[model samples]
Target: MSAKQTGTKNRSPMQYSDWPIEQLPGLSQEEQSQLQNCGIKTTVGLVKQGKTLQDKVALAKKLQVNLQYVNKWVALADLARIPSVGTQYCGLLLHSGVASVAQLAQTPTHRLHKQILRLQVATMQRRDLCPAIEQVQQWSQQARIVLSDEC
Candidate 1:
């Protein structure tokens, strides 16, 4: 076990914020387990190489899975690293083609907000999927923080 995994019995869940893969956004519980079963047990495992399209394709080939799934998982890992954008919002962003917090941080909030509104309208069955402007702003701000911290 890693030093981070050590003493898990005594650690409160909130006591650690370093488990990026465990906290990956946009994944159902089952999908998370599946990724681990397929040997992607860490955020670095999925995204260690700058998370390029080529990297995702390589992972898909290595795991013998669909490219789309690998892409989404990489995106989820990246987004989950941000403090404010949790799993639920991660889904919303995924639908908007946001594959990383780096992308989110660079996006203009108004553009993302409008894009989400359009997505909601296109997928009209889920009328309750509204994301507030303030929340998106916070996500973008937090994404910036995460990017800086990684550097």
Candidate 2:
């Protein structure tokens, strides 16, 4: 069975140009500079360079940072490939347990919405700031479309 059949979907390794790494949320200017210095100026570059655990480990070693840092950045970069998700919502989705476009595509919107709402309320103390159910559904739908396009 394929990864998808086993309930673990994987994104295509195709490298496509996307928003610059600086646009990704939670990355500081210094972090952006460090990545740019290593030829990972764009999200797509980061994703391509850190496609696997070994790749992420190599990147972290090269940057002299922890593996988790590269993992988070790569996850953000991968999620940002979704047109609707973009950089603005990548961090949110990651924190909400939707790390990649594949995960988001398989996630049930109702459950994912609840997770996002709880996270927002716990972190920001603002339930109103959570994306609506329809928006969450749209994200999942778009993620599926993206996965299909990749295949």
Candidate 3:
């Protein structure tokens, strides 16, 4: 089904831009710099093959850091790469207890839409914040593809 068929409108969703890797959530300043030194500059730059986290394991080994930490950053960056999720929306998802793309993949689209709606209301920036169910479907589908161990 299409968004138009489902009565989903654009609602002026927030626009996202590429941010420095240091801006990725859940990472300390040291870790951000570490990734930067290792050549990861932007969230989009971290992953190459679609939604996969690219070479997180290899990067961890090269950086001599905990694999979990690298994996965490990779996941966050992956979510940021979603068409509309961006860094700001990723922050909202993290604060709302949705941490990983894998978790986002599991979340019901209606629930995500509801939570995001509540967030927009609570924040009082309701301008064009409403999202259609179809957008959430795209997000979940993309996450699922990324999490299908296809990386």
| Residue 136 miss distance in model 1 (angstroms) | 0.5
Candidate No. with top lDDT = 2
TM-score of 1: 0.70
Question: Model 3, range 81-134, lDDT digits (tens) per residue?
Answer: 554566656766765567777789999989988887787787876936666778
**Residue 135, model 2: Cα distance from true site in angstroms:** 0.8
Sort by TM-score, best first: what order?
Answer: 2, 1, 3
What lDDT is obtained when candidate 1 is compared to the true structure?
A: 0.67
Tens digits of per-residue lDDT, candidate 2, 38-82, equal 998778789889988999999999989999899999999888877
Q: Give Cα distance to truth, residue 127, candidate 1, Å.
A: 5.9
Query: How close is every model to the real structure, measured as TM-score?
Result: 0.70, 0.86, 0.54
Candidate models: Cα lDDT each: 0.67, 0.82, 0.65
Q: Higher-lDDT candidate among 1 and 2?
A: 2
Candidate 2 worst ten-residue window by lDDT:
1-10
Which consecutive 10 residues in model 3 have the weakest lDDT in total? 1-10
- For model 2, what is the error of residue 29's alpha carbon versus the real structure, in angstroms, after optimal superposition? 1.7
Distance from true location, Cα of 111 in model 2, Å? 0.4
